[model samples]
Target: MTISNLQEVKSRITVFGQPMICRGCSHEVFIPYELYINVEKPGIGCLYAHDIAICQNCGEARHFSDPSDFDNEKGIFVWALRQYVC
Candidate 1:
């Protein structure tokens, strides 16, 4: 929201320079995974599901979760997703 550097303001998508509107409220939101990391709150750490991009207007969240986290090939988030889905 309060961006100081022009270079800092970038597209929200992972690849960068790709803008997309929030599905919930149709409000414009950037998916800049990098910017999100650099500008994160001190204790936020790495981004997660609950930490996905959120709409400023309606609080709709854009899920940027890692699919690997859901792979049975590994545990972690997948185990959590199964518990959540089942």
Candidate 2:
């Protein structure tokens, strides 16, 4: 499918060889999105990027850690924001 159609595919998205199923409605389709979570606190939180999929049926979101890890394996995987959601 084309990138434009990807959001509408409504099909199972696999992560690490596993199918993503929505737990809220048992839906097999999702709208893929990338999100960053603040893993740090007290100061500038660690903005870890994640590959997220939102259930098209129930609006539930599931996240999968990005494999890149910004090429850092240590130091809590710190990195700068490089992804844009909108």
Model 1 weakest 10-residue run by lDDT: 77-86
The deviation in Å at residue 75 for candidate 2 is 27
Ten-residue region with minimum lDDT total, candidate 2: 77-86
> CA lDDT of each candidate?
0.39, 0.56
lDDT of 2: 0.56
Per-residue lDDT of model 2, residues 1-86, tens digit only: 22222343355665444566788888767766656778887579779766667787889987644332334445464332122122
> Could you give candidate 1's per-residue lDDT for residues 1-86 as a string of tens digits?
11211122323433122344688777664432223443467776865323355555676766543222345565544321110000
Candidate 1 stretches with Cα past 4 Å from truth are 1-14, 30-51, 65-86
Provide the TM-score for each candidate, comma-separated: 0.32, 0.49
